[model samples]
Target chain A: MTGVTISGVGITPFESDAERSALELATAASEDALDDAACSLEAVDSVHVGNVLTEALDVQGGLANAFVSAVGLEGVRADRIENTSASGASATHRGVEAVASGASDVAVVVGVEKMSDADTSTVTDAISKLTHGREYVQGITLPSFGGLAAGAYLDRYDAPREALAEVAVKNHENAVDNDIAQFQKEVSVEDALDSPVVADPLRLYDCCPMTDGAAAVVLERESDAEGVHVRSIGSATGTHAVAERPDPIEIESVSRASERTFADANLSRNDVDVACIHDAFTVLELLELEEIGFFERGTAWEATMRGETARDGAFPVNPGGGLKARGHPLGATGLSQVVELVWQLRGDLRGDRQVAGAETGFAVNVAGFGNNSVCTLLEAP
Target chain B: MTRGTRDADGLRVDEAFRCGDCENEWYYTRNRCPDCQSATFSTYRLREGELVAYTTVNVTPPDVRSANVLGLAAFGDVRLIAQMSDDDPEVGDSVRFAGQYELREGGEKRARLTGVDGDG
Candidate 1:
């Protein structure tokens, strides 16, 4: 079992830059990553990009190659990897494997998505296709499914509504110093609580915004790398559709992936210094925390409300503000998590948002109601 | 629609192919007994089971406004996803089929299941 090392990482500012196309953003991020690693396009052997609905968004086919060529990486093996919203992590996993297996000395992974240009309903309709098409024909959107899961969580665990609100407040506070985040201003708890409801038990603020952004990471085998070590990588899949699951909050796939990664790294939950669990929805963070074994079942809300997961709390979770405040460009989200982890591990982050003494970190990417999941463990060099 | 035979419990039961020698019965859909690799099978309407998993569709098809609850039920080792009639169902709750219900206007149909009597 050879180890893979992440030599460098990069990200585009997650904001409404309607003037620039998705490929332009991707090129910028890719160049940043390559430059940070002190490597050039000639040194890279493969390129992996993640974009959820590039075709649906009227982007040309072979978009990955198009972006790579624009970034002056033509003649390199390039391909797109999509797995619902978790496309970024899926692509990263592919790139890591390429390096670890000696198929390539260096591989670059990029995630980009432009979601704000499309109509909300159209975006919702497109995302719904990730579920059972027959089910989507019934008009089930992500928000609807999220609401159902939130309701179940609230009912079964007696999860407090206020605790969920706390998640938004904490993330927003952390985002205040994140210049690249979509929402840089903090909001009061009352503002979060009073926001319009998108789905029952979930307000507008509780959900991540429809953001447009890109993120990239450069990976090289440990023997050829000059950076942080990829201690372990694990992925798992569960029921295909959310309706097929026994409990939405259980997230069996995520739990399995986390357990496998921990075992592979020969570390326990207590060893993780920081974590970035997918917070597509605020409640998702709570469920992920519990499912990842950070806290006991039915206690994530309590842990959150008690400030256990705050930026300066006992265990800093989502110091990058997570998808909730940092903005969620579906394709870029998983890669964005990796970028934050790399920066934290390297002590490169500026301002008040840095996680103190962070050495080992974990990132969990859940796709389509935990149907597909990937977990990665990172350690400082 | 052809009316299926009803069992002693008054639940509708449809006949399906079953290996006479294997004595294996399956209800919804299958070409053969997956267990023994026998191309033979029999059908019996599911009588009793428990909800294995469930989720509600808040944004339903154009025809429906209220959330539609759905779940998978297990009768012995056989499991299938079906429309749930109960408002809130917990995993392991007993369930019984309530016959077929119209799922869509274009002849789409599905059998409905509810919590067992006195088990709700």
Candidate 2:
């Protein structure tokens, strides 16, 4: 099988709100990625758009076709991939598969979401529907899941409430240097803990804000491209209902996906130099780290409190601020993680945020409450 | 395990399903058993269960109450998520199904759990 390489990656400034349409943001990011690759639009054989809310929130459809038209690309195979919040990574995986299978020599993967135009309640209600139909009727929002999990984690492990706050503190601190991050300011643990309660035990700072943005990556069939190799991608599905899982705090999907990713790449967790995890909620960073084998169960909070996952720590995670601070534009988040990994592996970032001597990187993007997950491994060129 | 044969009320969230083949119990509605893929299944009412986790949802949907409490309760081997009548409930606390109520505007009437006496 032919290997695939990320020739270029680009992203729009993740903002709490954006004035542009999803299609416009997607086109701009795709153009930037194409330019970064030094490849013309004509060289692109396929376009994969990762998006979820445009139709529901923006009242727009046919985003892929519209993006291709906006970019003046003709007759290229266009497809839209939507896996809820994991849509971006799913699109990246799809584009890489196209290039790896020789179905397309050059593929563009873009993830975009426009959420600011909608009402706050509308956005929350729409996101709430991502859960099982039965659970949706119970009015369980995503933050409720975080709050429940945080409560359970704290009680079960006897972890300090400050441990959860530490995640936001570290990620926000890292975002201070990320120019495209939505919140480019450090938040102290006190600030996080004092934030208004969105759900019991989970203050506002623990949750990712609704964001609008786009990110794109160019995948090329193996060549002399000076880019990071798309080593492999693994995906898995868990119980649809969060309550159905035997252990509410255990994200089996992430564990299974990471297991498959490592096994397929013939590597171990120790091989990962840096990681961009799906920290949609502050507690998620710790839970996912443990699930991905970076830390032991119930000990992730202890490790997090010790700053082991900080940018300068032994197992650096989310140096680009992750979803908590970098902004979670739903579909764009997964691709944004890959974009950060590409930059890290290329050593193109500034000294402050760079993961030094990074040769391998891993990223995991999860759907609602770990209903599904997609994990990718990237190796330096 | 037949698909789409149940009446509207038959699909209520309060009902739990048991696989005849593997004897596995689940809360969600599915045609086949997740464990054994058996089409033979029976439905039972979720009357009482132990709370595995609970949260007071301060931020609810527009139609729901502001400080809605929710919990994941286990009925035998089946687990279901429902709104809690108790303001605060701890893990391992006994909770019984209170009744059905609309948790959201235009939403279905879902089951609600309340902590047993002095258990919350």
Candidate 3:
């Protein structure tokens, strides 16, 4: 196992109507995390901020230094990491390295995104531009990729369309128990099917909403303190052009990262009790599960349809509602997933939502529709 | 026709590069071959391909048309992402590069594909 231990975690509510600036949100989450770890500002040796689109949308820069001053931390190393949607996990990787290498005694990583004030068109345009320049000019958005992949997957496997909607239905139900979820309410299969179509064969419910939030975690060398151990983190990058892949449904980034992570940690799939997958779209949840070796190719959809991934199922997935329900604030989503897993491993979750005997948790955060991905494994102390 | 000096937008919609070392072809222009790391390349134009997958996008960016259709087409060993001039193209259908059109506001004219009749 890695020498890094997660001492504390904190997350602000995921909301669409953000009333606070990104700096304020980040400061608040950092304060909560430091408080949880009983870590004083003077003890933090480094701070890494995971953020994207804030400077573009809010026209603000030096976010790391800004957060350092806001939290009253001085003489600590600080910087920002940007990797599209996987920025949080990348920052966490840096934090873990700092402590694992004895560069710092304690490190705090905060990821924040505030885009509620921006107009919908501006946000959509910015996100769409994440694709390759050629594809962007062709007007291909992330949801379009989801729709294309979903259609191909269904036709190739002869899977029922209801399987896709079932993912949305289940995630929405899970969100009902998640107070911090953006859409903390249940949605029926019929409701999902009837929802407005954003991309063909993928309804509005199939996609994650644009959210504003921040999540933070404090890391230190493994100690006797009550915390979760950072087992390992694996990352990989695939073809930049989505169309260039030989197989449209194959997410090389997820599979490669998962393989490396499991192998590096000397762990097996059976060891993971719960998972927080990047379900930016419902189709992605099934695709990633298969890619991660949790289920066979062309079979995760059926498993999902049979309720095998529910909170009470043998293999629980997205126990914290997932991005489809919890919300996706781009940069903050990866760290939020870790926060959820940390809480689950620590048995901090309330009734019904907690995995009864959860000791190991897995999380995968993807960037730019699987152009790159970072997989994280956390174990109970 | 090979015009190595032309910019992406100025080049033909079907324009692409082939590595001299590995013969790897791709749509995006790169100084060196991604597969063989060869600096030598030749330009080529793709006129036909097979539709691999497609989607009808209803929630589009502000600059794009509503209900814009996009598709991934396979040309020999290469793949290209382009707009679909026709909405009813099926996967595996033989498609031809129809031409180019402005798919987004303030964007360069990009390629468009259409299903060729009598070809699956």
Candidate 4:
């Protein structure tokens, strides 16, 4: 199979700015990407945008085209890809496939979400719908879902509650060096421990905040590219409903996707120079590390607290601050990870948090808890 | 189990047949009946399973309870999600179906599963 290469990528600093619409944010990110690639909108062949709750946000339809038109790429063929929180990565995957299959010489992918415009309850309700419709009607929101997984992980592994706080502190400390991070200020483990509880075993600090942002990437065939090569891309799905899962900590989708990606790239976890796994919640990062075969079962939290995933540690995870601090704008998060990976692989990161000598990178994007997952591998050519 | 039959609501229902010819239990939503595959089947009350997982839906759907609990049980090799009985359920609890409940103002009718009498 032909390889796909990412020529350039860009992301907006996550913040609460009601003045800018979702399309505007998307266009800005796309412009940055096109600038980095030394190309104009007229040079692009196709566009793929990722969005969630655009209809709920009263955007009606034509959101994908709206992004293209706003970016002055009116003649480009465009479509939208929505897979809940993983929408961004899913859209990136589609754009990659388009380039790999020779469907388009240059494909542009953008992921944007404007959730702050919606009321808190409405946004929570819309996000909750990502779960089983029937199950969500009962009272299961994302926090509670994470809480359940936390409870199970705590009981099964006897993991200390303090370990979760440590995860938060590590990510926040890493974010301190990230200028664009939403929560760049460092927080102590004590601060995390003292924070009010949103759900049992999950404090306010343990969860990612609601964010609005955009990320974009420019992809081309390997023969046509000038930067990092997309070594492999793998995606898989699991039971949509949390109640249907056999074990919340052992998400089959992530495990399968990571395995497929590694196999396709002919690499293992040991071959990876750096990684950025989804960390929507603290426990999620731990579980994902184990699921992606980084740490053994029941040892992720322990490894994390021991500084295993620290920026300067042996295996740095989420060097871009993760969703915990980098901001999880839902639809934009997956592509944002890609942007960070590109910077790391190119040795262009201008911060104290850059991963040193990151030659090969892996990223995992998970949607709706453990329902839908995708893993992509990239190597500097 | 019979292959084609419509329920009162016009929803298609099928029965799983066990042996070609024998008195066996027919199952709904199964590939084959446990007792007789005579291809003949009938719907019967399915009971016996522990709630392996559950989630309470905060979002209300029609007339359903605002905090309705959804439970998943592993009966034999098949695992399915079912509505919880009257009592609140936790993960790894046991539950059984009682009877059908009225649908919320324009929602599909559902059966209620109650906590069983044994310790889970």
Candidate 5:
């Protein structure tokens, strides 16, 4: 089996106050990645741009073609992916497939989001539309789902809010070394528990902040590759409305996608060295770990409490911090996850933050409250 | 609500349609069955169910003056997303509707989930 290899990865600093436009952020990352790959714009055959709510947030559309034109890479086959938060991973998967299918020799995938330009209320309303407007989300906010889900998990697992606070504390501590991370200061469990209630049982610290940034990955055939080989990319879709599912606690799409990716790569859960499960909400991290088969059901919090997910633990998760501290710019988040995995697999992380002797790395990018999922597996040579 | 829009004032009724072939039921309006892609459907009423999940949104849209408590209520095989009347709704608490909560005139009017008669 053969898959495209990542030759270069680039990212803009994830922050809440990035003044740059979406196009500017994307072009900068694309150019940086091409430079890192030692390739020219002329060598690129296709462009994939991942963006969410650009038209609503930035008043822009036709993102892919416009990006190629602005970056002086016109006439390349270009496409835009809009799978909400998973847009970046979706675009990367498409880029990898393009090279693997012989449609392009070299492809560039850029995920960007410029959300700081809008008001907080506007941003909140925009995200709510991700669910069914008429029935589920017109008046309801996105964090409402987090609050409801967290409350249920606590009752079902016999866990307390302190368990969720540990995730915020750990990720915040990990972000101290990540220069581009939005929050570099470490927080204590008390600070998280005492934070103002955004939704009952879920404090402000439990949610990922709105962010602005971009990241890029360049994929080429392995014969001309210079980085980690994408062992497999698997995707699956669940019921559109989260409540419609029989089991609200389990995300069937993530499990199915993870299983397919591991199967395609001929690997098992035990073989994975580093993993990045989406942590838009602290409770989501615990559930994703369980749903992805990294841990037994209702036991991920114990692992986190035991320091098993730390950078030096048995299997480090989100060593460069997660969406919790990394800042989630929706579209850019998926690519940022891939960028971190590439760094970990290449031993590019510094200090103890870097995992030792990492051989296999994995990541999952979820979209629109687990309605869709894209799981990618990378192998180190 | 246009022509053929039926209403039951006594009980909260959501017009649902089930696929005649696959028995896939949905509360909202849809052209085809998501499962079997069947066009033919039988319309029915969804009256009452239990709360699957809920939350109180402290920060809401500007139009929503007070904190909006929302709920995901299950009626048979389908779930309805709506503004819930119960200030503190348990996961499995029975929820029925007393009246429509169309607070805004032109805004979207979704279903309302309220504590049933017997359940507190």
Candidate 6:
């Protein structure tokens, strides 16, 4: 709805307990973004906050209000948007609209989460409540969906588990240079296979960790620098209960949203120079790539097997390690994708991690089990 | 079929609810038909299903102690996540609608359109 350009982006380390509080992390990120844009905090017209599991994990609520006060964007319209893991992108979508629709001249959108407060088991169970209550809440964890989907994909394609392993290895290798990445160490296929199994066919390396981090983006109707413009953004919802999907293996929301976003931008998938897809699970990397039409059905994994998605491969994907290696702090992940793309488009990243001559980039953020998804296409001016 | 949440004897497993207006059928219990949003419905019991996909979750959180074996089984018009009784479930297995079995031996059982109960 809104024609917005992102002029500044800020991100914190994915693993640290630094800043101590969600609001503090968010304020710091916002400050960095404003400073990056050479704009004062008072210039922000509105504030949008994205977060999930905050009360359960961070012991806080009304985060948008807290952030506005911290940033001196007081009395401006503020809203907290949540769509599970897609919260960040959803909030970005709202901020973009707020500015584009003449509602706000400049909107400060931030996605922050502090997930380290709770233990792993408690945090895992807390997220289970967001899944299909009829089944998933009982026995199947989110990684179980990855395992089941991996089994189905391998069976459908007659492929081995190596394709999934390749995603973990490649993303980890990419993360090695990402200063803000949680895991700096690269992983190997053997390491992934030999790691303890969380779900059959998916090992420790195949899963993204629960991280604590914050990411911020400054959006305005226009930009002065080599800003990345929001070409198009599309959002859609699939079946909340994944088991009830007509095609259990396909993420229809990602497919539909990606198509709409590209169509909105009047661009085709071939125009994309880079992408940041949600890889919360290793199997997700393949499934999302296939559903989003980057690679044909049953072939994305094959491409990965050949290093097609590596930083130096045919089409670079998740050069900043993705959620798998970058560490997904729930809400921070989606906006973080946009940040990585902004850096790539501006050629701000280092040589090895950057996509060469990247003029356009694509980012996709997915909610629980693909229940909902938001896709954004970004282009450099 | 009824809501499958109760751990006790679940509703009939073989029987599935179909919308009277739109002829849409779904496995899970719902107040309104998802297709036409019609509340009127009829029930049909299917004998068996074709196992589509399955996985075993070995490492889980504290709440889940045992390895979780779950699968998607298609019974005519709809597919549902069912707890697999077999340790190694194969896709396309000719699984009968064995209904929901309680985890405890001789525990009260409710039959929902889940999947085949293991040797129990």
CA lDDT of every candidate: 0.79, 0.88, 0.88, 0.77, 0.84, 0.83
Per-residue accuracy of model 6 over A360-379 as CA lDDT, tens digit each: 99999999989899999998
Candidate 5 fraction of reference contacts recovered: 0.58
TM-score of chain A of 5: 0.98
Candidate 2's TM-score reads 0.96
**Tens-digit lDDT track of model 5 for A32-126:** 88887888899999999999988877668898988998999968999899998899999999998899999999999999998887999898867
What would the TM-score be for candidate 6 when compared with the true structure? 0.93
lDDT of 1 at A15: 82
Clashes of each: 7, 0, 0, 24, 0, 5
Worst 10 residues of 1 chain A by lDDT: A132-141
DockQ of each: 0.13, 0.60, 0.60, 0.14, 0.45, 0.49
Candidate 6 regions with alpha-carbon error over 4 angstroms: A16-19, A223-226, B1-15, B42-46, B97-120
Chain B TM-score by candidate, in order shown: 0.68, 0.80, 0.81, 0.56, 0.74, 0.70
A183-255 per-residue lDDT for model 1 (tens digits): 9989877898899776667788888888899999999988877777888888999766565455556788999
Clashing pairs in model 6? A2-A100, B9-B109, B9-B110, B10-B110, B13-B112
How far residue A318's Cα lies from its native spot in candidate 1, in Å, is: 0.8
Question: Model 3: residues >4 Å from true position, as ranges?
Answer: B1-9, B106-110, B118-120
What tens digits encode model 4's per-residue C-alpha lDDT throughout B1-120? Answer: 111121232321111223445655432233455444455554444566676655454444334465555555665444555456554566666666565554243444555556777322
| Comparing 2 and 6 on lDDT, the stronger one | 2
Q: lDDT tens string, model 4, A35-89?
A: 8888777789999998888886776488987777777776777999998889999
Best of the two (1, 2) by lDDT: 2
Judged by DockQ cut-offs, the docking class of candidate 6 is acceptable
